[model samples]
Target chain A: MIVSPTRRRLLIGSAATAAAALLGGCDALVDNQHVARVLEGAEALNKDLQRALLSDTTLAREYTEADMSPVFKANGTQHPEGDAYASLLDNGFADWRLTVDGKVDRPLSLSLAELKQLPARTQITRHDCVEGWSAIGKWTGVQLGTVLKTAGLNTDARYAVFHCADKYENTADGQYYESIDLVDAFHPQTILAYTMNDQNLPVAHGAPLRLRVERQLGYKHAKYIMRIEIVDSLKAIGRGRGGFWEDRGYEWYAGI
Target chain B: MFHPRSRSVGKPSSSDVAGATQKKLVFRHPLLVRLTHWMNVLCLFILLLSGLQIFNAHPSLYWGKYGADADPAFIDIRAYRDGNSIRGETRIGSLAIPTTGFLGASEYNGALSVRAFPSWLTIPSYRDLSTGRRWHFFFAWVFVLNGLAYVIYGIAAGHFRRKLVPNTNELAPSHLAHEIADHARLRFPKGDKARHYNTLQKLAYLSVIFVLLPLMVATGLTMSPAMDAAWPWLLDVFGGRQSARTIHFISATLIVGFVFVHVAMVLLSGVWNNLRSMVTGRYAIEVEKHP
Candidate 1:
């Protein structure tokens, strides 16, 4: 059947617009699995690019004492909601034991008390939130290396995973967690801070103890850390990359 | 005409080290340009820092079609869930400068994000969104005016054609491939034209100049409620406010990424020569063979 040119053109235009509308609305335009793959690829490429282009230990520019923002907003869940988390918080986190297990010769579970006893490093570092605010505070905590050494990381271990109690529910099954490479994990300033501004870490500020990997963005500093598992690969963990956040679009290594 | 490849190929740039008379070259970043650049930089820095704070509010890509489920780490997904799927499209609280005019007199809402530090630290309490809007708006003027003046001066002074824009032959597919290879290996060419930007520089600069800056301005305007009163078409232009924000973030990330690459290139392609050109406006060059 012969179609008129004008009618054909109209049909083409309508089809194009319909296709675009479908792209803009329905999930048919692009596959969810493909979307996942693209994100995963971007995540992998970004990690390689970061490692190749950026120095892992290079610190984000330190601001002057004067540049410090007057009010430091506390973001993320202000306080954990679960009863298990509540019990830990109720006891002043004294009973909180940050375990360093997995691929390590000596698996050790140190109480927040024991963590505080180690040789600590204090830095008046600035926390550069991805949200666009900057705050400077004195963070004091034991170096992650001190604990890594205490536990004696296995030669095969490559990444240090921080499993936290904070379950920011996308579902009941998945939980919030993060990880880091050995270099960032062992950097002198990278500590499991128990004190902030000369006080025991407040619940609002990732208490009992929170990570202060002084240089990276705040998310890498996993709050409410329950255990540190040293591993050879991230493949076995959630989504098989690194952190739960890392699994879901956030760069596994968010170096400042 | 001269050799067709001459434009693309090596040029015999003058130098004093060859026992010749001193060379003369002039360039300068005017006060307005410098001020504009610094202001834009400052804006970007703060935006990134504060934006990170709101990432936890929610972490989902509610982009066109293909938008999917959440994978842990995203905040409040279960609370806001429907039909057994969490809406992972926007951050919990939209990324905005929270504390504008309420500075120094505000109390806590009890919302504490590890990354989202309180508005107090960055945005002073009681200082409301009005002040944030001011800094953001005024600085935007600096960005726009500076860009305009730069374009004008760059063209009038031959800086645009001579320094910033790449020659025609550089746009070739083969040339494009080599430039990519060079960028990957960090092997920047050397000479008078070498100090002159390669294809990548031209592409990146042109994209930022013509494409990105405009997007920033458009998106900034689209986000403003006042802008709706001023111009109704902005909503149509960006599709919607949420879409504008998404594009703005994505483009800003691209620009910041470009800055990182640009700086790295400078370090690789003789930091001293590049630094000299930028600071003193005389990029030292390796004179090619005068065959």
Candidate 2:
């Protein structure tokens, strides 16, 4: 049997990927939540007390053209796989719907077309990845608040959960998911994005839809969003915690 | 004569035992460098990994959105169909991954559910961070002191003034282009001189020593609310705590990147020669005889 270099690369990549899947797949491998929870709480309290003390910060430091690193890689869900994903892929996600339901008095299921009709925001922001890389790109999207108001947010609703099709981990309990509070939900720049760098969001860029929450690190912006649930609490969600990644031993609130 | 600290374990005197086995990696790093580098590396890695978990909480970056806890949430905290904590839902608890198929899986946000880790353990030991912080804080003195000593020594020894400092010529376009082409072609300078860092390596080492390391230390110190109280302008330096964090990550990334390139270059140039010099400090070569 002959294996070309491209084929060899593919095989090696798949093997490594399989190894990762298996490790993450371990049902016995439970999510270590204790210290993670404490750290989250500590970080929350810490940042809360120190929230943007730079409120008076003058202009952000300017950088020379030579300062930007030679390369800035795209991160977080560069691609979404699966048949459900493919179907969404077929027609450019024209039929796709982002569901905003739960405690809201009015549950609205809006399509890509309907969301575009709402007020949109565009900003050139630097994405700081937790993996130690940063990239600056322009993202355009509808303010999540606009969507919530259009759907009629309930006074009781206190948190919003974003359901993504990408499974970071699989268990008998359920697939993965993530969540955040309404303050971010209503932030002026917070949006359910459909475009990146002025182009329709490519699949490599969480096409169809991706969340853009500027305040937090890159991971908070869950890509491949399939549903948005507005509820009064995080308890009902996976692990009675907030998100899928959180369920897997991540900080719940990664501000900045 | 070199200072007492500068008394390098250089060429051994004839009186010393030649048969003695080599000592381990120099604790020459001094108490400070050892503490700061180790502590910084530790704190940084935890911050990075756990920060990933936080990002997992919500992986987006918006213009005005600040993924904050101060504001209200969209989910209901009280309303429970089966028993999912609805509001802010203790977003902190979300970090625990449960072992599925074993017990009642906890609910996330609402409707969405996941397995929970056994209530007893956490992945990152809180003790490690606490100790690491202490070492980091106290050891910071060591790093700063060692750095100061090295700087003073470099200047007094004329090492920095002679070796590390790039001449104006180095910054010239033609010189830079020559350097790049030489690098691409792997046409390195010869002998023990080459064994040591080249102009590029010297610049990189000098930058890490003078620039990135100090920035990492300052930004890390800026993160402390206690420290910030005494020194608010620290925040101004990097824009804010978050910005400091971003800088910390960026600095560490650069350091790690430098390490990768440094190691690669060492291996590429001449592995044994490079390793032996750093280890034994006696690089073997025929010293050319001038007639």
Chain B TM-score, all predictions listed: 0.64, 0.57
In model 1, which runs have C-alpha deviations exceeding 4 angstroms? Answer: A1-31, A82-84, A130-134, A170-172, A247-249, B1-291
Q: Write the per-residue lDDT of candidate 1 for residues A117-230, one digit (tens) a residue.
A: 789877776564533233567778988888888788877999998888887665753676788889778766788888877788888888877887654566677888888898
Residue-wise C-alpha lDDT for candidate 2, range B88-175, written one tens digit per residue: 1222223422323222233333433332211111112121222222223333444566567666767776766666788787768897
DockQ of 1: 0.02
Which candidate leads the pack in TM-score? 1
Of the candidates shown, which would achieve the greatest lDDT relative to the real structure?
1
CAPRI-style class, candidate 2: incorrect
* Model 1 C-alpha lDDT per residue in residues B72-158, reported as the tens digit of each score: 222122222335532222234444232212321123465322222234433222223322322333345556666787778778878
lDDT of each: 0.59, 0.56
Interface RMSD of the candidates, in order: 21.4, 14.7
Docking model 1 quality class: incorrect
